[model samples]
Structure formats: structure tokens, C-alpha cells
Target: MGRTFHRYKPQKIFEKELQTSEFYDCKEKKWVAVIPKMKYRFVIALKSDYPREVFDAPKYYMMKVVWKNGKEQVFEADTKDALGDAILRFRTNECFWNNLGRYAYRVYLDWVNKSGRLLQ
Candidate 1:
């Protein structure tokens, strides 16, 4: 057996919005589609609930997405710290921080570093 390591392939989609596919609403007979694919994206997930913060500073963007039988994984957009929270709210909105914002994103990174939250 050999050890395996994941290469640092930052997802480009993290800087953008997350979208999802659409299914035909048989009852309504309406072709519905989610603007962004949130199936495997967290930044996109943020938009589903938090739109205003999507463009907030600090610029939190999606990094990556992984799925297992009962778990998920994700990553961030920028390597540098500091920025506003206005755009960082969404995991997809990428941008560099100013100065003070660096610390804020660092703290946020604590939660951001997690692969995924356990489904309670």
C-alpha cells in the first residue's frame, strides 16, 4: 500500500457564485433551474440563504468540494489574509483583504478550514 496526498488544486469556481441544475416541475409544468449549482459548492450554498453578504468584503470564496457516504469537504479562495466581510460572506466571492480584515478572515478560516459540518 502507498500513502496518498491531495494536491493543492484550488477550485476556480470558489470565486464565482454557485449554481444548480433544474428539474421540470410536473405539477406546475414549469422548467425550474437553480441559478447556480449548489450540489457541491459552499459559496453557492451561502447565496441560497445569504445573498446580501455574497459581495461583502473579506472575500470568502469556495475552494473545493468533496463527497463521501456521510461527509463533505470545501476550501477557500485567497491565500492572503485581510479584507472586508461584505463580500466574504459568500464562500464564492473572492478578493484580497485591506489590513484589519486579514485578522477577521483568519479567525473565520478556523471554521472555513473544516472539510464540512456534521449533519446533526
Candidate 2:
């Protein structure tokens, strides 16, 4: 039995692929990357800032949430109830007492509870 191998022809310089830019202007051969003006959400791990050895027994998950138009909210809690209260403080500060806010609060509540729903 014999086998035949096929080789692809080398592409010309004009046919070579190039990196694409979302903000590129092909006609002008220029690109200006655009940064979004709005920030929707952020989950920051505040615990990583401290070394593990600093704690006798780490009692809290230090965390931060940056939500809607660059507002930042921070919390440190060991228990589910504490976390819920912290989140409530944030929600209150942001004036998130509306119906939509309640739904979002539920989601955040579910996340903060290690055992079960505390804010519900």
C-alpha cells in the first residue's frame, strides 16, 4: 500500500492574515480602541488582600460589589445573617427598594448564604 501527501501552497504576502481590531479603520490603516463608558457589575475578592497567616481562624469572607454606574459596596461577614444584613445596607444606600431590586436582592442573598437562604 502506498500513501500520497498533499501540501498547501504558501500564501502570498497580500493574502497573509492580520490581527483584527474592533475599532480599526481599514481604509485609513488605523485603530483607536474604544473603552466602554459604563460599568455594570464587579465582584472583588477583598480577602486576597490579606495573607492567610494574619488570621487565627478566618472568620469572614471579605468581599466587594461594584454595581451600576461605578458605585462600590463592601462587606465582611462570617455568618449568613451578617452577610444578608450587609447586603441590605448596600441595597438601602443605593435606594434599591423597588420590585426589581427585590429580585436582585434574592440573587445576592442566595450567593452569600453558605447553609441556606437568610434574606428570604
Candidate 3:
């Protein structure tokens, strides 16, 4: 054989520059996604305390998504594989374009690490 061609690896896209924090959710009884940079600090609301409009905002609320199989679930940052799979499936399957596509896109950006494995 004169020559052989092999697939070339692309340059790494993620810089690993983002800072992340692990917070425990006492109500959910599980670890939540790493908190990204915020312009303002988040307020914690106690069950016994008064209700605040800011606390009910979408940004402060935990993101919940429904799967294609009709099961609803909360998206977590710790589970990269599941998020990656969902991203891939969402991109490839047109039927899911309307349902969980929006949530999957958000999770894709959240869970994708420096390795960029989910992009592949």
C-alpha cells in the first residue's frame, strides 16, 4: 500500500475556564448542577418564610424537562452522559425537535466539559 488515510482529530473547543460550584438541595435530596456566573446573588427561600417574587423567577427555578417517552425529569449537571445522549438524539431525531429540544440545548451547554465529548 502506498498510503493510508486516518480520521483527523479536531482542535479542542472548550477552554475549561468556567467556574462551577456544587450545591446540595435539601428539598430535592440530591446534588444539583454547577452554578454558573450570575450578575446577582441567588436568594434562598424558606418554607416558613414569606414568599418573594424574585424567588419564583424562572432563572432561580430548577429546570424540569419531559423525555420523549412521556416521563418527566429534572435535568442535573452531574449526569453528563445522559445529557450528551439527549443532545445527540435531539439533534438527530426530527420528532423530538418540538418537545425537549429547548431543554436539551440548555443542558448541552451546561454539561459539556472541557473534553467536548458531548459535541461529538
Instruction: Highest TM-score: give the candidate number.
Output: 2
Tens-digit lDDT track for model 2 on 3-41?
A: 544433222111111121224344565545535532324
Candidate 2: TM-score?
A: 0.40
Give a tens-digit lDDT track for model 3, residues 10-114.
222221121234433555656566445211111111121222333332221222443323464443222446444544555654444433444346544643443
Q: Best-fitting candidate, measured by lDDT? A: 2
lDDT of 1 by residue, 1-120 (tens): 975543333234322222336434545656566455323223222212233333443334443333222244443434322222433554342222221223334434544445353323
> Candidate 2 regions off by >4 Å?
1-39, 42-50, 90-104, 112-120
**Worst 10 contiguous positions by lDDT, candidate 2:** 11-20
Worst 10 residues of 3 by lDDT: 39-48
RMSD in angstroms between candidate 3 and the native structure over all alpha carbons = 21.4
Q: Kindly give the stretch of ten consecutive residues in candidate 1 with the minimal lDDT sum.
A: 93-102
Candidates 1 and 2 compared: the better one by TM-score is 2
Error of 3 at 40 (Å): 22
